[model samples]
Target: MSDRAEAAVRVIEGSLRKRGRLRDSHITLAHGSGGKAMRDLIEDVFVGSFDNPALAALEDQAVVALSELASHGDRLAFTTDTFVVNPLFFPGGDIGTLAVAGTVNDLAVSGAKPLFLSCGIVMEEGLPVEALRRVVASMKRTAEQAGVYIVTGDTKVVERGAADKLFINTAGIGVVPEGISISARNARPGDAVIVSGYLGDHGTAILVARNELALETQIASDCQPLNGLVETMLRACPDLHCLRDATRGGVATVLNEFAQSSGVTIRVREAALPLRQEVKGACEILGLDPLYLANEGKLVAVVPAEAAQRVLAAMRAHPAGEHAAVIGEVTGEQAGVVVLQTVFGGERIIDMLVGEQLPRIC
Candidate 1:
């Protein structure tokens, strides 16, 4: 492995060893009472796992030097997201992993290298303390894997029925390298549209985990950090026109946003889209469109046609994007619209949904 890769592995391994055991089976109101109990919980759980000089200080805020930030890029990218997925635990990941990956992906797709994060966690009074420890450990592992740090955080406890078992809000900061100006409006006519991998895995996995449809299938949420994958793609195609994570509204919503922002039409081929067998089956049974489902780890890239092949090749080389494909292209005709050619050879416009199809799946 490369030196950088080896270092990352070590970080994750060290974090795993530092995780603290939570002795309390269940949480109580005192854990959030801003007293000794709260102090012990924070020190033993979050700080123990996410050990680093910045976080070790236990200050009200983290201070990063300007030179340290300037060395990475000329522009800073900042974003925040809240994760409240029902059923705190899922097949492949839990709320903690989702919280970290979601925020990291947001920064990554903006052509940035994610660096720091602040986490705010809310726990219900009666929730299991062990469960909180597990989630915090997961977050620590994910941050190490992503090469970012959780520098500051806050914890709150609410009445048992006033909140869900747990909820997490994360704010992230990253550095956008010089000469990299990726944006939805940068997409132009003839730009090739690429999807990193299969769609709807996350939405389908959450649906099955909830057991709301009485369906049984082995599908795991595609919740993962995409910064490493995005970094590889940028190396191959530095002039990438646009990049957007296929989150809440999935690939379809991302494409529509690109079309509207760039004032160009996006034409996607139905057969070219990639979907896992389980996801396809679930969508069929649920009478839902896979294109509109949510995905946590996937992203859509629009680059010049000349660089599409190189970028796609680079993406496929990464583990996170093994199923990457060139699914469509941008056009000047029918501006501000997205057209999907059906498997039956019919074409139809894809519009943004007036209401959400799946709520709190992310």
Candidate 2:
């Protein structure tokens, strides 16, 4: 490993100081050997932190009783994510919340109702036990709030000099109800493009927290699960064309992908996109565009012109979609292009980001 990597490992180990009750000089290979050391580690650390009925069972696979969900014969949607935010925690949430939210949104944007999640954690030899515990607890809480269960999990501890403090991977499963279709390929010309709320809050908040950059206003990450909001919108606008969470490359990349996949053009008005004052200020200072920054809580939707009002109204009624607006419209011409109409009436092409503006942001 390089000097910086070595130093990072040392820093992580330094954080895992155990006092009176603990009796290990440093994490040994035995800790991961699946023997006594491993059992003790699981019982004392992993289980102690994420203890719940499902996890406590310690079964190879959870015996889920999903009669209510299974009886409907809804198509299942599944997604997995790994989170390695450098700061571990950010303004609105920590890695735990991000893991859950990311998974939930993935299923939601696919027109699915999230059901359960399984977490896998890799811990460095010396991460603070309390911090790990807090993360797991937060994950449980967030999953509950999102109406999902953390049904199973696995834990592994690496050598003191081997890894970062924590890395969490989560896999989730959900059911897609019949008659609901949503995807990038569903967008069509004349469809109205809508966003649930303000953009770039998550990315801006993370930048501020990680760099300790001082600004006049506070920005909190918009990390949240959109399953419920999607459900409401589906009820209000059953013919909704498409849905997507503006993550990673944000609204620009998502729109571009839709245009390419569905063979349509998206014309967005710069003045119509909603962004918080604090987020806008931070983006300006950082030389970032809110349109390309990541968001965890917000969603983009495409609906027929006749269904736009009902869809927007349904979104606004939900807490997650209060700032929803019709930001753009799909066009038959200029296929595979995303154009932004500036406040001065000039048009510019918005393309996928060549590289990530912020790395390890989610």
Candidate 3:
């Protein structure tokens, strides 16, 4: 088509588009029947809010130009994660927010520049349409803030008892620039271990929201995207050995992964660990360990000893990493183990978590 003709066609397509509407207050199986009702739900709630050309196409898939991808980097980094956090909505973020941030962080930790995402939703029948709208809205806002697009997705409805109220699965794609290689196994014997910010806020926030723990203090989930922070760190020191977002199993689990992968011992000073007073209090009251609590907007990085100060300075300067701190160091002794030098001058092993500390917390 000629350029003018193509422009006219786009105008016509835009004019034909209508904001979707539905009369039902709650979702029914009909909404998932792949008919007008399904179309309405997707358009009015998702498409209207997401508002992007690739998603507005409403095809079975999204197609991007290879040239656009080439501009970002050399390799593609892909990751997928499912979020089933109870209550659907929590302080600071909802299931929709987790759906995006979780997948984006997964890609970011791999030293990739996140670019696009796909969302898949499984909702129980009879859910309120307003609830769905709110969650979808959150997804749109989070994706926009992350500077990525939600270009494709799927929706399914199951029997009321067959699934939770709603579950979201987000898969992300990013580009890894050439010469920037990072892996869980890349840690060196003299590397420094650092965390982006305060720990356990997400788990603590969920606990408070659930009211299952009977806690009464102000705390919000640290559920922000981390690609921006990761970018700054890479610019400061491209030779970062390892990067992992502390999620399900928390910082302790992430350290264990690095230690085992790199065949090194991680020695952390307990006092150096940064903690929000509220989170620490909650953990202490509940006989829980803060190091094993989940974090949504935090990352643990292994930096070469020489670049540790520089990388940490850069991290502390970034919005996502303002509270960043160095908590530990990698050593050659006790390969594959993490040791803690306690505040009282005693040492103990920080073992890999065997069971879920805070379930459904991602």
User: Number of backbone collisions per candidate, in order?
Assistant: 0, 0, 0
lDDT of every predicted structure (CA atoms): 0.92, 0.84, 0.91
Best by lDDT: 1
- lDDT string for model 1 (1-362, tens) is 99999999978855554464545778888889998668768778888889888888878999999899999999999999999998889998999999999999999999999999999989999998888988999899999999999999999999889998999999999999999999999989999999999999999988988887677888899999999999999999899999999989889999999999999999999999999888888898889999999999999999999999999999999999999999999999976899999999999999876598988897
TM-score for each predicted model, relative to the true structure:
0.93, 0.88, 0.94
Scanning candidate 3 in windows of ten residues, the lowest lDDT window is: 13-22
Angstrom error of the Cα, residue 339, model 3: value is 0.5
Better of 2 and 3 by lDDT: 3
Candidate 3 ranges with C-alpha deviation above 4 Å: 1-17
Off by over 4 Å in 1: 1-23
lDDT of 3 by residue, 1-362 (tens): 99999999967754564543666898888788898678777877888888899999999999999889989989999999999998788899999988999999999999999999999889899899999988988888889888999999889988778898899999999999989999999988889999999999999999988897787888999998999999999999999999999999889999999999899999999999999999989998998999899999999999999999999999999999999999999999977999999999999999988877777887
Model 3, position 9, has a per-residue lDDT of 93
Q: Report per-prediction Cα RMSD to one decimal.
A: 8.6, 8.3, 5.1
User: In candidate 3, which residue pairs clash?
Assistant: none
As a whole number from 0 to 100, the lDDT of residue 95 in candidate 3 is: 92
Candidate 2: what lDDT?
Answer: 0.84
- lDDT (C-alpha) at residue 99 in model 3: 90
In the range 1-362, model 2's lDDT, one tens digit per residue, is 99999999967754453211234644555666777666555565555555567766768677666777775446888899898877887778899999999999998888888987888888788777667756877787788779888878777888877877888999998888888888789888889999999999888888888775677558889999999999999999888888999999999999999999999989999999998888877877778889999999998999999899999998899999999999999999977999999999999999988876899888
